[model samples]
Target: MSTTKIGWIGLGTMGIPMSQQLISAGYPVTVYNRSKDKEATLKKQGADTAATPAALFQQTDVMIIMVTDDNAINEIFTGKEGLLSAGVNGKIIINMSTVSPSISKEMAALCKEQGNRYLDAPVSGSVKQAETAQLVIMAGGDAAIFEQVKPVLDKMSKMATHVGDVGAGNVAKLAINTLLSIHTQGLAEAVLLAKQNGIEAATLMELLNNGALASPYMKIKGDAILADNYKAAFSLKNIAKDLRLSKDIGLSTPIGEAALKTFGAAEHEFGNDDLIAVKKYLDK
Candidate 1:
């Protein structure tokens, strides 16, 4: 493995734990978040901090971003004092944000023009998975670059796969999340039906857990919903965003469209809560 310094941008639910995995693996990591408060926590955990993205980029050859959306990505990468303002020769930039495929392609082209490699490497899994380094990372980039970064990626992901060239990662992510959103909503409805028909929510979930329909998502999220614990593994609003993305990506997804409406309502009511809160919309 090359002694390349790792730079992390973003410290939200997923980013914090993912970065910590790299640090715990003994990588020299420098982190930057728009909100500087979390930087102190990460700094105490053996990671370095920079006041700006440009400053962070100045000190590292490999940068990983896990910000919220395209707007955040634009501001952090193209705004004043952004990464592009810094010299980027021989740098590898991996964007793990859940943005549109087009933007990833554009970012990759721009970085290529500046003699840097860029990868759209969004992840699948919730915060718990992130903390446990069990994320499934879908990467889209040059295969050589993907190979070079696989070791570092493995520190944060149980599976890191190069799906294809630029834009493919987000495309793959959108497709996956379409099923996720619909399935989550379906789970919500099942809980609602169980509760409404006098069957205990816990019993229904227990039966589902033993059946072929159960998944890792259902096991964790099902228990959370049964307990009315809305603490987010994945925020309802974020899943709603992904639902909208799936709809907009040129797919005539009627099921996704319906799921989007259900999640959209739940997001409006409990946007910051766990996606399991979509159950709140189910009975009402």
Candidate 2:
């Protein structure tokens, strides 16, 4: 029953659905996006649309940003017409993008200096999970602030946890994405091996799904691979970006190296395709 007005930036796949959850829950929402056309649909659904980030921040108590990367995040929050220009006093900024922990820490510090609260709140899940509000959100920031936003976070995710202090959410996201990359690559390699040895790829997937090897990702993405559906539930290029971020974290990842290379190549060839499309590279 909190009357906090919400602001949303970014209108990409996950951003759209995540914001919809808030709007549907009867929260007053003001939204802004780089492309104004994307606002058309939200505007019709009882959400207010702002012309710029500064304008959106003016009417918002909590702003949820779900942009692509760190660069995009910096652009909207620091320029002449950015969020800071309007003052962030008493505002809570939650960043839910996959980005570097270092950058998240830097933004958190800057927001703190301006008397605002910040959270590094990256999410785990793909398009379907987002649409269903089943994402796992890992948030990092002050414990009190996290408690303040947990209800709002709950409306957008199945589980939202305060993992640690500032920057910890990105760290958790990178580690999770590393494992995601490894699982996807391993699955692709196995399917390719089966196909090459006269075993049907679909058959192998069926067996795997019914056995202890079954995973939510394997079941979902494996079906997509089997049907040759690469409609970008999660793009190969983004996974490559996450893999690069994982490496930059300075963790030793001998297994991830090969998976990264495979995904890097898949990105080079099929950047916009679904991550399951890595199976195509292996099929060749």
Candidate 3:
């Protein structure tokens, strides 16, 4: 077993599998989640459980956070019984959540003040990739610190690239998510247009999959669209949140602006569903 003591926060869809990768890789891992029941699966895998974020930090040298939104991120780091509450030092905090760059920078500075290291290391790809240890991690932090954690990160990702200094990963993630929104919206519009003009959904998807626009994402999401399986691998509400976060970070181009409006509107009814559920919203 590896000697690095790791602490994980959050056990959401992506978090559960990603943290499992580390445990399976033989790292000694301890987990903490607000919903205590989520810790059971990890515990069964021989992982330890901590009562709180501060307790988890105290037990481990590295802390990995993968939670929902900026609010949850704030709560994990600063709320009562949070990691910061312990007055720890020489620890590293890796935030793999999709949050604003500003918050990441703030957290990085706060960690520095306490003599701890921080990395904004958000990921691309969804639950499927995470489950299979094929996630692409975009990290921003000190190069040396990134190198130190690369092996641990490798357990969960197919690739982990150090993009820049603190908060750069969040910027890169938001940029990628913005384009993802645009691509998904474009795909939905194309399929809807084809359906309206008397062409079958399968036919257009086949052409798109085989033609110049072909991609793994197109194939996976295309299959989901054809099957009408909008079951939140990556939810509609999250993309809408990413778009809003993008706008706050200065994304105002025409296509991005339109996709923001489109996804924002779709979030009202299909927020909990898969993002491709936008196809249904547009069809209505």
Ranking of all predicted structures according to TM-score, beginning with the best and ending with the worst: 3, 2, 1
Off by over 4 Å in 1: none
Error of 2 at 161 (Å): 0.7
Q: Residues 118-177, candidate 2, lDDT per residue (tens digit)?
A: 998999998788888899999998989999999999998899999999989999999999
* Model 1 lowest lDDT segment of ten: 244-253
- State each model's CA lDDT, in order: 0.89, 0.89, 0.94
For residues 188-263, what per-residue lDDT tens digits would candidate 3 score against the true structure? 9999899889999899989998999999999999999889899999999999999999999999899999999999
The alpha-carbon lDDT assigned to residue 267 of candidate 2 equals 89
TM-score of 1: 0.97
Candidate 1, residues 1-284, lDDT tens digits: the string is 34779999999999999999999898899999878898988989988888899999989989999998988988887889998889668899999999989888888888888899999999998787899999999999899999999999999989999999998999999999888888888888888887888998899999999999978888988888878899887889999988877777875768878888888877878999888888877767
- Candidate 1 clashes between residue pairs 3 or more apart in a chain or in different chains: none
> Every model's Cα RMSD, please?
1.2, 1.1, 0.7
- Model 2 TM-score is 0.97
Question: Could you tell me every candidate's TM-score relative to the true structure?
Answer: 0.97, 0.97, 0.99
